[model samples]
Target: MSVKIEKAYILKSFVINESDRVISVLNEKGEKISLVAKGGNRLKSRFQGKLEPFSFVKVEYFDRGKGGLNSLNNVELLENLQKWIKGDMKKFFALSFLNEVTDRFVYEKERNSKIFRLIKHVIDSLKDGVDLKLAISYFSIWMLKLSGVLSEFNEEIQCLNEILAKPLDKLDCKEPQTIFNFGLDLISKNSDKPLSSADMLKNLI
Candidate 1:
């Protein structure tokens, strides 16, 4: 099958053999594709720079079997997220956690415009230097809302609007984990959608 590589970002890649690696990518079409790359891990490999996680790229592929996983025929590097790749621990962890959540929940070959836009907003926000915690919380709230896993920002929760509007340093997410959990409870009480792991996260918190 031949299709335009709409919005591709390298999410994660790992070595499989001496010269090959398995790469996971997120596309604008909201696909999670697993493809094998030859010599992707070599220091000077053709895919060295292109396959780095978080680097946005435009790509083309070929598939001979099922509908989702395809072979990467070519790729065009678009944005190198290297600078933002390594930085403050909190920001990095927040980013990684969101990406992992996305990777797990999004279906292969399934198209979700909202998720796509959310991710685009996320990457751009991260790249552009938005307050890291604010950015993460924003995306988290948006992600839950987008997935129908959570709902609108209700005002009933204590100072929810104020929290959203305040500076990260000024806000005491005293226990982000706990706050997030409590926030969800307040949301779920007001929401109609079925809560999943996001709902479960409240327990973990």
Candidate 2:
């Protein structure tokens, strides 16, 4: 079988036996696929440190065509994502959440350009020193936007701004849930339109 080399981001990994690993990778095709990297968990493994979760690498594998599991041929190093993972605990936790969610959103060989870029952008941003709190919120908005849960926010955005202008201690003095529900309602109402990243950021302030 001729092997197909795909550059992918490792989203999740599970130890298979004691030597190999089963990984879910998100490829540039915006698809998530599974592969078994034989002998991937040893001191001198074929995959080495490249198969760790959230690593981005050039992966060589043979597509089995039956959609069960692709056979990995060889692996190449690209970005290990160690900078982000090894630096900040909060960002690392956020990465785990995003990785798992992205895995669920993308299916086997299913392409989605927006979803692909959104994830890549957020990961890259984290690598570039984005605040963890803000990064997580930004990531959520972007992912929801990609997943069609964020739409245009003209009406709600205006209300949000107006509502936010009031001193927190004065507004409603009674229900925190109302503000939370307001944001949810807006998200539900505008999830189909193109959501603005700037507007989402503004909502954070």
Candidate 3:
């Protein structure tokens, strides 16, 4: 098996057994891939603090070829946004919604650098303290646009023209609630099942 190292953002993880964990990540190339981390759940495992959700990491793994999970060898932490929003419930749920939407829309092993950059941009903007509602709206619209479900002339999203034009950090929305609801409606319609974080986010709004 050939070993490969790549930069990735952890989307989610699942504990498979007492010591093993399955991690899903969106790599820098914009491909969603899952890796199995041996002893990942153990206290002293090398992966102990490196595999949390929403973390940016450099992962070394053995590529076992297509149609199978890769085996994780080592992982190095690059950035962890979890700490920044530790005591903020709204920010936490917003990040969770973003993660879930990305996990749902991105296809495994299919490269789309636009989506990858978009994710990086939004996360970076969040770190820099951009308006939360505007950031969420920006991500939702961009995801729809990138997935071919939205168009510039789409009547429903016309009110967001200014929002789409500005950078996330420079964005100003006079009616953020309107834009947010529109984006959320589109996301709800596109998703197969109900989004787990949607209600939690809305209740907090």
* Candidate 1 lDDT over residue span 51-139, tens digit each: 77766788776754485457776788888766766675555555565566667657666667767667777667667766554555555
Q: What is the TM-score of each candidate against the true structure?
A: 0.71, 0.70, 0.94
> Over the full model, what C-alpha lDDT does candidate 1 score relative to the true structure?
0.63
The best candidate in terms of TM-score: 3
Off by over 4 Å in 3: 151-159
Q: For model 2, how does the per-residue alpha-carbon lDDT over 1-205 read when each residue is reduced to its tens digit?
A: 5678988888888887888788898888787889998888788886777788878888899888775689888888787776746675555566765675676556677787666666787677666765444444444545555666534433433333433234222233233334344544454344444334324433543
Q: Is candidate 1 or candidate 3 better by TM-score?
A: 3
Which 10 successive residues of model 2 have the least lDDT summed? 167-176
Better of 2 and 3 by lDDT: 3
Q: Give the lowest summed-lDDT range of ten residues in model 3.
A: 150-159
Better-scoring candidate (lDDT), 1 or 3: 3
- The alpha-carbon deviation from the true structure for residue 3 of candidate 2, after best TM-score superposition, in angstroms, is 2.1
What RMSD value applies to candidate 1?
6.1
Q: Cα lDDT of all candidates, in order?
A: 0.63, 0.64, 0.86
Quick one: ranking by lDDT, best first? 3, 2, 1
